[model samples]
Target: MAADATKSTAGRTVFRHRLSTRAWHWLNALTVIVMLMSGLMIFNAHPRLYWGHAGANADPAWLEIGATPTEGILKVGALTLPTTGVLGRWTDRHGVVQTRAFPGWATIPTDYSLAGARRWHLAFAWVLVIGGALYGVASLINRHIQRDLAPSRGELAPRHIWRDIKDHARGRLPGGEAAARYNILQKLSYLAVIFGLLPLMVLSGLGMAPGVDAGWPWIVDLLGGRQSARSIHFLCATALLGFILVHLAMVVIAGPINEIRSMITGRYRLPAERA
Candidate 1:
């Protein structure tokens, strides 16, 4: 009886997150935060948006009537939506000047350091890119990507995807040995972040970097130009931020305590149904 009890308890397992995943996740989070904050400061320099303008023109409209921040132009494939925050500025004829403002929102004061903002932005960007590269290479070498991060062939089938969708819709998820491992949703999210959004972010950023034009003129040409690159960079950053929110929501829905513990301590107690 005792032996059976022991076996049952043992089978009621406590699955732990691999140390590498915990390290990579937190590092990615921190570096991305730094990049986002510094990027915002840098963006404050040119808070205006332009449909098309190589340089200034004599027309009043060409004078950039107001700053319309590109923060809300989120796009992936063909879908597009107005996101959050309309960055702008206003200067009253009476000589009162304001940095940023929206219809019913608060006004933000502007700073005068395009050079410094660019420097800080580029510096933090290096951390994000370098850290992400290291994490990717390390995951490859450690078999972390292959073992836990990739979705199974069967999981990629329409039936499995439909089931996952159904489960997700109902706020119920797969558990068992399957859930102990990352499900297809987790795998796809990781893949999209690492392969799709992250790389696009880095590339778009590099396209805007001044020195890059000398050697990689094609990058700038490919993305349009420096200003266009900046717009794309902002769009991708917003998408990544949205993904982070959904990721966190999933963790919470799954099990907040266990999820937080896994991230902090690299250990998660597998659900009861998981073996």
Candidate 2:
């Protein structure tokens, strides 16, 4: 049986989040937003991606976004998409039409500032790493990972996993005492983001930094070199962004008031048991 320490009930309301969890959740939210925005600005400095150790403007890019005299375009291999009012070109706050890959509003400083963007990005990168490390240790010490996230053998079975997928697709959320515990899908997604995606993002980020790369050349080498690391880092960030969007949609679907309160005040009103 899954342990639900935070779900111990008083009538319909249950304590649903640890202080550590809530703290980290809020901190991570702010951190990721800043990191993402600044990273976009950084990427705008060179809107091209390649696979090898070295890449240049002259080299072929697997992906590229740029503005021609008439329109903005994003090219992925041979495929191209016109993106005039977004992506490769957009009007900034100053009424100037900008040709940056990402618009100013979506970036830090809201202007073209590679050095400024890198500073903001790198600072928050450390916050993410340190905060994540502390939260990881705290979760382990408190058995949150084991009790909440580690799926049982039965949950891992193909049939059980498929059923959860179907339920989610149909908007069938867990209810009653079941609502007090995470569904298998929630457990798996949380586990992947916490363990797999985040760590790789950090490592790939380090591989792209000149200082880190020079100090630990192996990091870049392991990822197939600096250019490859940058590409992988971009992809990982894209995945994380996707995860955040879906997670937000699920929160809205599952009663945002209750879900948000749980992370804020650590109390949740369990959904009524389906009759």
Candidate 3:
């Protein structure tokens, strides 16, 4: 009777995210949100980006957010765009004109306080680092990364990747058994985020910390310099933000309830097998 029940259940659902993965997923989500908002607030302190070892108001910046005699503008490279009310200048709820890189609504306290924002940012940075480390260990021990995220030889083929891209463009997702497994694109995305962007974010962030740099000057040197590290950190943050937006959109397109439930409960109801 137990065997029969197991077989019946297997026909409808599959174990997708593990308990550890689910926990890390939600926890990481919270920590990343806190980090992003607070980081933006920190950026408000210096709304400019530059390349090379050292940069200041005296030097040329690759990017700057400020207001001209006419209107607020965001200057990047050789282009300048009007960004009033979003980037350079905007009016607060009290009808007072304010100048900041990011608007108040987009920042963590929704007010201008770099000190308060740093506290929140640092606190969550620890959480992300510790949680990511544990998740990495668990993934290795459980062979979850190997079996699920690592692309197979066949999946690594260009044809396979192109097919996945076309399918995604056409809003066609895998069903049944295919749906239960990660596709080539999904595997690559997860690998990039986990191994590439996250590490860059952590290292570049440490590079910006005065205390961390004092202890490990090599970190800042490896990245080129303090200002360079700051620019790289901002770029990585922007990439991560893009990933999050795409991830949420894919979830909604693929079936938000089932996709979300799988992350929350570890049981995913597989779509009907395609003919």
Best TM-score goes to which candidate?
2
Model 1 TM-score, all chains together: 0.75
Reference-based lDDT, each prediction: 0.66, 0.91, 0.90
If scored against the real structure, what TM-score would every candidate get?
Answer: 0.75, 0.94, 0.94
* Candidates ranked, most accurate by lDDT first: 2, 3, 1
- Which digits, one per residue and each the tens of the lDDT, describe model 2 over residues 1-275? 32353334323888888998999999999999999999999999999999989999999999999999989999999999999999898898889998899998889969899999999998999899999999999999999999998999999999999999998898888876788888899999999999989998999999998999899999999999999999999999999999999999999998999999999999989885544
Candidate 3, poorest ten consecutive residues by summed lDDT: 1-10
Q: Which stretches of candidate 1 lie over 4 Å from their true place?
A: 1-15, 50-98, 101-116
Q: Which residue pairs collide in model 2, if any? A: none
Q: Tell me the TM-score of model 2.
A: 0.94
Q: Which residue runs does candidate 2 get wrong by more than 4 Å? A: 1-11
- Candidate 1 worst ten-residue window by lDDT: 101-110
Q: In model 2, which range of ten residues has the least summed lDDT?
A: 1-10
